[model samples]
Target: MAKAFASQGDLAEKKVSFTEVGRDLWAFTAEGDPNTGVIIGDDSVMVVDAQATPRLAGKVIENIRTVTDKPIKHVVLSHYHAVRVLGASAYGASEIVMSEKARSMVAERGQEDWDSEFGRFPRLFQGHESIPGLTWPTLTFNDRLTLYLGKRRVDLMFLGRAHTAGDIVAHVPDENVMFTGDIVEYHSACYCGDGHFTDWPATLEAIRCFDLAAIAPGRGDALVGEKLVNEALDNTADFVRSTYRPVARVAQGGGSLKEAWDACRTVCDPKFSNYAIYEHCLPFNVARAYDESLGIDTPRIWTAERDLQMWEALQG
Candidate 1:
């Protein structure tokens, strides 16, 4: 019998966590699921990443209301993934900020990604109907954009291309807190389907240059203290290297895609097998690594059909 396509079978509800990472920074994590960063300023709040759907985001809003009645002033995206940005409408923030490149990716393949991801992971879309449509950024920045939440200053920096062409990190200078969307995952697998392998390490280096007291990653528990924070960054860097290096080597040798996939798994699985989404992401990650190793810089659209085709071809 054929295997189920991608993450279709991963419908179990994950345990959610809301923990304080900084003075007023909160991380909403779901057992290695996609996380939401909460930054409370003097007068208002800033949400780092929107959840999957409006109903999902409502839960985050409920938590935000617990501490502060202050309105959420801005919603910032770390990258252009549908699971991260589609629930943006629920925030009602004055500005939805994203990197200019992310906005372009959304325009090019947002609808297709929505369709593809909703099918792959149903738990994140419990209230899929509540999503208004594709989320568009009302404000976009080329390299960096700075915003002040009263006294606190938030710097959104595009630390080169890693997870996507438009990956940005939100750095809170005073508190030494950085919300690195998908660019840095703790124990969770780095979802590299839309990633830039060769550029990821350089981006990670740029992130390391910051003196981070705490890090709220896209998934996994909030990393606090210098030791754990360094571990998370190192782990993320290791994951990207483990997959891309083996796959790139295979691709460079003119090996088949299946060979690239197997070679990558051989190198990565021993260490990352237990990470969240490891199995679901292997095919797409390997596919991207193979193409990028061959010089395909711009990512190809991943439709539901292509997702299943690649999954079957690699894992069947």
Candidate 2:
């Protein structure tokens, strides 16, 4: 059976919907589940982010088959997250692309993240044993890489650090569309556990510079119009601010992590009550916010033990 989760208890289960945003641009979204964007070029194809596992991504590839028969040439990792990049090998893409910073993050904490995420979201990692190992990018760049899928131009650029140091957005100029992987999510909880909260808003602003008519966000539904795209970015920016402010204030006041978490809950839970993953993201979000508020530059690795300890601290 296909498992599902409810968002707002109004949007139907398995919130997966595909909207053709432009010529050969399709957004595969599942009710605020991690979205996979597809760009079909004349000669080949490029997938924005692989799903959580080969089984999950194979389903996406099956969808691509419905659109075109050309081989999938590239699978891009927007950042090093188990849910995003683990299914990369399934695409059989000759070139798996990522930012150099993201590659480093994979080298440093990918394994831990894999374990951590598997624990947090067992449903996403349904076929866990099938994951060969940490998915490594064959091609990495500092800022950007442009590919010509026949005559179509797909520019992958690392505008700034947001979700992770190596976050990148895939821009399709002719389509006036951008695939923002977790950099911007509409009506969903922003996972700041491994994020750069201070840099996230600026990154969102940088994304606004593009005259994009549509966007395929990492989660939530595909933003099909300029109005919806702006709303996604603005809502994401507001969520980031709401996440950081209360935690920072409490931390700066010399309050305990628990106190900071309480302050954050009081503010966020009320407004973002309907967002997906609110319960799952809050503890990690507050922990990262507290760390940033205390001048911690890089996010700490989250092991199973650390996750439990943090949960207990917050629950108590």
Candidate 3:
């Protein structure tokens, strides 16, 4: 029998943790679930990556209130994904920020993506009705947007295309801390549904310039200290390469999609099987890798229908 599509069957709630990674920086990580980075400036706060729904964002907000009552002045989106941006309303942030490219993507398919992801991860979208339509960025920049939290500075940079074309990282120069969206995952599976396999490695190389002391990735536990941070970076890079290389080879060899998925699984599952969302992300990741290997540079939009079709094809 075919399994449930995407994470719809993943009903188990994860335990949430609000850990202080730096002076005023906090990582709200829920086991292997999606994470939120909080940066408390002198006056206000900046939230990186809102949760999937208003209800979920409320939980993050409650955590934020525990440490500081500062208004969430800015909500920065690392990339344009329904699971990440739909919670903007909950923060009531003055400025919702993201890359211009991400804004374009939101304009292009934000509705479809919202529908697609909500269906895929029903657990994440518990209060689906509370979402007040699609989230729009009030402020968008091309490459970098520097936010001044009094004397401190948080530079939002678009290193290159990896997880998505508009993927960006928030770097705290003074602390040498980074809030890397999905560009760097720890134990969690890197969702490559919209990933750029070729450009990702180069993007990973750029992250080393920060000489990070700590990193809050999109998922998994926060990486503390230089060594662990680098290791997580390397692991994320490996996951990307391992998922792509085999699928690319199979596609170039004119292998079937099932064969390509099998090749990807043989490599990824051995190392990443126990990781969070490995099963849910595998089919979509493999499908995108297969397309990219066939010289398709642009990632096709993922709709609920396409998601199911691909899942059935690969799961069979």
Candidate 4:
């Protein structure tokens, strides 16, 4: 059975609006769904985080057509996830960019992650057949890279690991706006299956340091102004704390995965139960917490088979 939070009723995917944050920076966001951002320059355009597949990305491109006609010269992958990067080929982007760490992750466990995520959420991958293959970045940097879009400055920074080891954020310095892939989510579950729990809090702090006039979060509506920005950061922080602490506590007591899952339901369900994908994320979150509680620093790779095993082990 497809697992979903009690709070998330029948959520059907739909078209989103393209909100302009700055002169040429805009964000396309669906209702509590993964977002795709566009950065238009004097000469070319850059796409941030492609949707699940080429068919789904066509919707994003259609939205882009309403804005500018510039060819998409660059496609930036925030991390190596099938949902985030698999649709790059659809854009016909001349250059695909990523952090070196992200590329390494693609080589290590990219296929496994693709299977796991596809198995978990089929709705996100609307046009499943449109997936060309795994997306590989043509250009990669270590920590940071500054790309000059004509006169516009778009900085891609790998501040720290939260969502994944290769997670990076797109910061348009001129606009004081940052597109946080999954590092910061507004009213959405923090999918921490590949996350760095110990380092995630610190990563949020780094994101907070930016002079953010507006923020395009991984899911939900975009946040504008400092007040909303602060709210996003706070909510994200609270969700992470609520997810990790209780599971860690339960695991430390020699609790089984089911015990930890139940504990999470009691604590996190009340607080973040309304967030997007909460039900789908809880079991994986608890499993990671259990591992972390035992002094495991890195999260275990989530294969599709492992996902089912964990779900069966905890759900029953």
Give the alpha carbon lDDT tens digit for every residue of 190-243 in model 4: 888888787888889898888689998998888899999989998888888888
The reply for model 2, stretches above 4 Å from the true place, is 1-13
Q: What are the models' TM-scores?
A: 0.98, 0.95, 0.98, 0.95
Tens digits of lDDT, candidate 2, 88-156 = 989999999999999999999999998888777777878878989999999999988899999999999
Least accurate stretch of 10 residues (summed lDDT) in model 4?
A: 2-11
lDDT of candidate 3 at residue 232, scale 0 to 100: 90
For model 1, the stretches where C-alpha displacement exceeds 4 angstroms are none
What lDDT would candidate 4 get against the real structure?
0.85
Model 1, C-alpha of 228: deviation from truth (Å): 0.8
Candidate no. 4 TM-score:
0.95
Predictions in order: lDDT: 0.91, 0.88, 0.93, 0.85
Which of the predicted structures, 2 or 3, would earn the higher TM-score when compared with the native?
A: 3
Candidate 3 has a TM-score of: 0.98
**Best lDDT among the predictions, by candidate number:** 3
Summarize candidate 1's per-residue lDDT along 75-159 as a digit string, tens digits: 9999888899989999899999999999999999999999999888888888898899999999999998999999999999998
Instruction: Pick the winner on TM-score between candidates 1 and 2.
Output: 1
When sorted by lDDT, best at the front, the candidate numbers are 3, 1, 2, 4
